[model samples]
Target: MSVTQADIDSAATTLSTVIRRTPMIASRVLSERIGCEVWLKCENLQRTGSFKPRGAYNRISRLSDEERARGVVAASAGNHAQGVAWSASSLGIASRVYMPRGAALPKIAATKAYGAEVILEGSTVDEALVSARAFADETGAVLIHPFDHPHIVAGQATVGLEILEQMPDVDAIVVPLGGGGLLAGIAAAVKARRPDVTVVGVQAAQAAAWPQSLADGHPVAAASMNTMADGIAVARPGDVPFAHISELVDSVVTVSEESLSTALLLMLERAKLIVEPAGAAAVAAVTAGAVDLSGNVCVVVSGGNIDPLLLSHVTTHGLTAAGRFLTVTATVSDRPGGLIALLELLRDLGASVVDVVHSRVADDLYLDEVQVTVSVETRGPEHQRELRRSLSDAGFLRD
Candidate 1:
């Protein structure tokens, strides 16, 4: 079924009472850096920390009495699980969410907190999806797919409606594609409203399904679950979304894990916003030079449900990318005073030592020249060089 603007209109009205009208934020720093008016569509701040709640609520509210009585079921990597769980809970409807065993702990906890029955089924989303479908059939519950179905696609299109309402002249929009619902919905609404506006899709290099799907003229097996953008790590494009992707989406770009980490960190530090790796894929594409934003650009930050531990890693990685964090390994004498001397030099150079390892006997040490390995954290590359100079001048033997 074709997604019409009428469906988008109905979805907007159906979900308006439940989902938030997420903010459209402007960034002068990004504008200056990218040489364009950079606006961030902050869906990360939407209900359930994603835009899925819009379509999920829309789809569930339309269920018949029998379907509602039987309850709802869904399988997700993370964000959509939370969305479905939250939406079902708000309607006083029972929901069983099948999540991959490897789904993020925080997402699992959040889904459970929404009062949905959490089922950890497999290591990958596809495996869990098979089980979810079977469970739905066995229990006679209504299966609410993450990205497929006419109502779901129309519901996702509400995001585009909100964006257009927020910024009528938005020049270009960069969307993150996983199951293709979000991309398809946004593309349908945007191209229908303003066909001249550019719409681009961003994918993680490790799980770039859309590029191949577009090439093969059909949905195909995406990459394995190796990307940090677990939100969009869908192995195949949904049929509903493929329809819009073929016609409306202007381009599909892929970004690396390193790019995602850098984008996540930058959003945290500069934008004061916390976006998950998947949510930050569009920004990653911009930073990685995958998408050209020569004119005005609106980067969709799709979700903010990032794991704290992963956030820490992304932050450190971002600092490294910005030359603000430096890690260096150096050899010092294993002797107590020798290690202390190196530590003092590092302190003098304004460098902090993160870890230290000492070797009492080494393969290439003199009679009294035991070796110690030090992993010091410096403020930046310049501080790292200064620390190296301080150590070399302190009579430390080079290894």
Candidate 2:
């Protein structure tokens, strides 16, 4: 079944009570970088911490009473599970979600908190999908696919409707590509109304499938899939979304893992917004100059449901990439004030030490020699360089 603008509009009205009409904020920082008027569709702040609930609720709401009684099953790495669980709980339907065993602890807990029976299996969403399908078959429960069905596409299209209304002058729409439901829905909805508007999709370079799929004129499996943006790490594109993407999407681009982490950190520091790596893909594309910055562009920040542990690692990587943090191992004398002298030198260089470890037991260090590792916060690349230079000039052997 094909999704149409009318179906998306119906989805909008049906989902009004179940979802939040997330804000579209004008971003001066991103606009300056892209040389265009940029607006961020903050779906990260939506109900259930992502846009998944919109589709989940809309699809489940349309189920027949008897089907609802039979219950629903779904598989997700994270966001979709919470969406289905929350929707099922609200509709008085039994829900069981299958998730990868390595899925984020917070996401798994969140799904159960929303009143679904969480089943952990497999190592990836594709593998977990197998278990979910088996469970659906065994229990005679209706399966809610993450991004393949007509109802899911139509439901996700509501985001396009809201974007159009929120930015009538929008000339380009950038969204993160996963299984393609969100991109296909938005492309179909927006292009149906404004054919001239450019619709772009961004994918993680490590897990991109849409670019090759589009190249071959059919859905194809990715060579490999590894990315911190697990939300968009589908190994293959959905045929349903591929159809809309082929006809409507103007361009698709991929961003590096470094850029993804940088984008996440930029959103957190510059915009004061917490965005997952997947949610920041569109921004990464724009900042990396992958998207054409010719007109008013709105980037969909897909979801904000990131694990805290992952966020911590991403943040550190981002800081290292931006040269805001520096780690240096310096061999010094193991005298009474050896470390203090090193600390005084760092203070003189104006680098704030965030963490330090003093070691004298290393094989390379002599009895009177200590190796000190210092993690320092700097102004940026230049400050880090200056700090390194000062340490080198002070006779500290850096390794």
Candidate 3:
């Protein structure tokens, strides 16, 4: 069944002292860029570093005495696992979580720290779910579906209620979509309270399933799922969430991987926020102009639990995508002064050299020429173009 305003209200009351009422912070940079007032709902700062706890706790707390005795089993990439583990531990209920083998190390550690018996299963959440379902069947534990239950949807709706309370004049709310629980719940709650407020859902283009699913009038599996936003990389939308989304959500859009990285980088640099790629989906959509948003826009930052190494890689990728980082191979004369001259020219042109690899022998290199691969930092696209032009003019760039 679909979640209602009353259900959302009841969930809010249940979560009144349970979940954090994350702050809604205004973004000057984003507001200026978007030509509208933009506020960021910082659910990234929520307990367990995500909004999953709201749904996980709400769903588990409502279990019967017998169900609680049997405990709970769930499958997730990371955030949801931690949510379930922490929620179960808080209620003094035993929990077992099946996580993908590729799930982040920090997330695995955090889940165990929350007192859940963690089992590293398959390579994806879908595969892990198979094992979790089996465990539930064998052990009589309740299987907590991440985003496909009425109680989970009702619980996530509290975020929408909080948003409305925080920004009564908000014109739109942009949410990250995966299995669609968050988006569907928010849409249902917001539409019931303020029908005029737009509720848009953003998905990673590579892992997006909603566009095709919505078109076909059912939850259809994505052809492929490959994106750094692992948290939202569900192969298909859950039937329960799809039902609510089809009827309630105003729009569904997709943002590119480059946009996700760029948005995360922007949040880190401009807002001093460490948002995971999935959490930055809404911001990515806004920055990429995927949706026509105006008036007061609220972008929900869903989670902040990102691996440090992945963060580094994504930051570099973002810089490269934004034309702030450049890598080029140039032919230089095989002389002692040639490499020095190239470095001097780069310095004079206001480019910061990050790394350089000098090679004297290659399949395409000539006897008198040395191949030098240089990675440089530029101001932006214009600066990158200028650097390339200067290199071409100096006869360093071949064709």
Top candidate, metric TM-score:
3
Report the C-alpha lDDT of model 1 over 170-220, residue by residue, as the tens digit. Answer: 999999989899999999999998998899999999998888889999888
Q: What's the distance in Å from true for residue 302, model 3?
A: 0.5
- Write the residue-wise lDDT of candidate 2 on 1-399 in tens digits: 688777888888899887899999999999998789999999999988999998898899999999999999999999999999999999999999999999999999999999999999999999999999998889889999999988899988989989999999999999999999999999999999999999999999999998889999999999999999999999999988999999899999999998999899999999889999999999999888987768899999999999989999999988888788899999898888988999999998888999999887787877889899999999999998888888898878655
| lDDT agreement with native, every candidate | 0.86, 0.92, 0.95
Cα-based TM-score, every candidate:
0.92, 0.94, 0.99
lDDT value for model 1: 0.86
Candidate 2 lowest-lDDT run of ten: 390-399
Ranking by TM-score: 3, 2, 1
Ten contiguous residues with the weakest lDDT in model 3: 1-10
TM-score of 3: 0.99
> Model 1 clash pairs?
none
lDDT of 2 at 333: 88
Q: Model 1, clash count? A: 0
**Residue 205, candidate 3: C-alpha displacement in angstroms:** 0.5
